[model samples]
Target: MEPEWIQAMQEELQQFKLNNVWELVKRPDPRKHNIIGTKWIYCNKQDEHGQVVRNKARLVAQGYTQVERIDFDETFAPVARIEAIRILPDIMHSVCMCARFQAAPKESHHLVVKRILRYLAYTPTLGLWYPKGSEFDLVGFSNANYAGDKVDRKSRSGTCHFLGRSLVCWSSKKQNCVSLSTAESE
Candidate 1:
């Protein structure tokens, strides 16, 4: 490999080691099954203030070429609510006040590192920035359609809340049960 390429690979490996993302397990070679291929991805790392301070590298699997029910099973993942996240600090404080204070548990940090690595690898140029001269206003919109659920004939409601023209929160959820009328839903 070229010197520059070697350097980049080393950096990526180092980051992987730090993250404890995954271990490369090796076994006896098979005749001809299926193996997913991966590629290097790079991106710029920004600080909490939305300023680029470093470059990140990652190794990402080419999931698109993978066949369903073969290489992977499910790609579904549940998302946390933004409102819940915004209340986390207060919840933590309440919990602390209720009992003797203790340090927060740390388990998902490594997984988060792994996720960051994958994200950086896949979107090397992607970044977030708070531009100057931006308006300050809070706006939101929600919509729902009945009989959209194929399983139980339930409606699906979607809401998106924005802050100063920036998308900050959104959600989509199926109703608990089929609503006979829209007014009954409210």
Candidate 2:
């Protein structure tokens, strides 16, 4: 490899080491374990004038080759949906439930309302907590309780957005239209 590329790779490895990104493991049997493959990517980071300022190197997994069930149950990607500004509730599922019954609250709804009030009374200072030096990465999650509402037969969808480890935004709402299948609800 060229000296510049080698230097970039070295820098990348140094950063990983400092961060304690992974640990060395003994080689597993080929028959029992599906070892993940990795690749090295190199690029030149540029300034506003399009002048190369620094060499960048990245070590990445070749995830595409892995099978579904045998390799993993679920895979996560760091992505944010620009269109969904207000999304899932890490909290306030009860509050959302109360809102649904504004027009006609039942005895059960009244009990839930009282319970919510009691919670508020006990934990007056409770609120969204954010720590110092939190990461800037945006993470979002969404799931639905299919046909959960007995009255309307509508699925309740909830979503939560986070900036690093801190909760940023969330929402819990009943679907506008009824969906027949679980996949359709999602």
Candidate 3:
């Protein structure tokens, strides 16, 4: 293996150990339970000019093999959709999830992930900008797309909260209930 890749893996293992992420225990009885597997995911971290800056290695649990109630119950993590201006973080998250489902991801997914990386390279300094002494008023804007998802025909809603001139929070998510009309979708 490449030295950087080895170093990245070592760093990941070190972090896990430092954080006390898991414990070594005897294998569970096959008749009573299942043991979830894990794997290492590797990637190259790039700089603004698209040059490789570092190597990244992540250890992820095989979530697919996990039984819903037996291995784990629920997730508290929040989900968000990609936006035009704030694209990298959300798309990166989506791509990571897609990668987990497939043993080998498709070419299209790779292209999408690469495109997001390129975009990030082009806009390395892009981020929320709040001028000093700006007003502190809180404001929010929200919108919805009616039956946006073609497969399921479900509506999507998004909202952004701003404190004065800076964005404080934002989210875009699919609606749980079917909307009869545009008004209802909003």
| Whole-model lDDT, model 2 | 0.71
Using lDDT as the measure, the top candidate is: 2
Encode model 2's per-residue lDDT on 1-186: one tens digit a residue: 788889988887887787676899998998999888889988888889999987888787787554443323343443211222233342355675687689989999999899878867776776655567757798989989988889989888888877787665677788798746555553
176, model 2: CA deviation in Å?
A: 34
Residue pairs in collision within model 1: 42-124, 43-124
TM-score winner, 1 or 3:
3
User: Model 3, poorest ten-residue lDDT window?
Assistant: 78-87
lDDT for 14 in candidate 3 is 82
Go through the candidates in order and give each one's C-alpha lDDT: 0.58, 0.71, 0.69
TM-score, candidate 1, is 0.29
- TM-scores of the candidates are 0.29, 0.37, 0.35
* Candidate 2, pairs of clashing residues: 87-171, 88-159, 88-160, 88-171
CA lDDT, candidate 1, residue 9: 65
lDDT (Cα, tens digit) per residue for candidate 3, span 25-72 = 999898899777898888887889999998888777786554443223
Error of 1 at 53 (Å): 44
The alpha-carbon lDDT assigned to residue 135 of candidate 1 equals 71
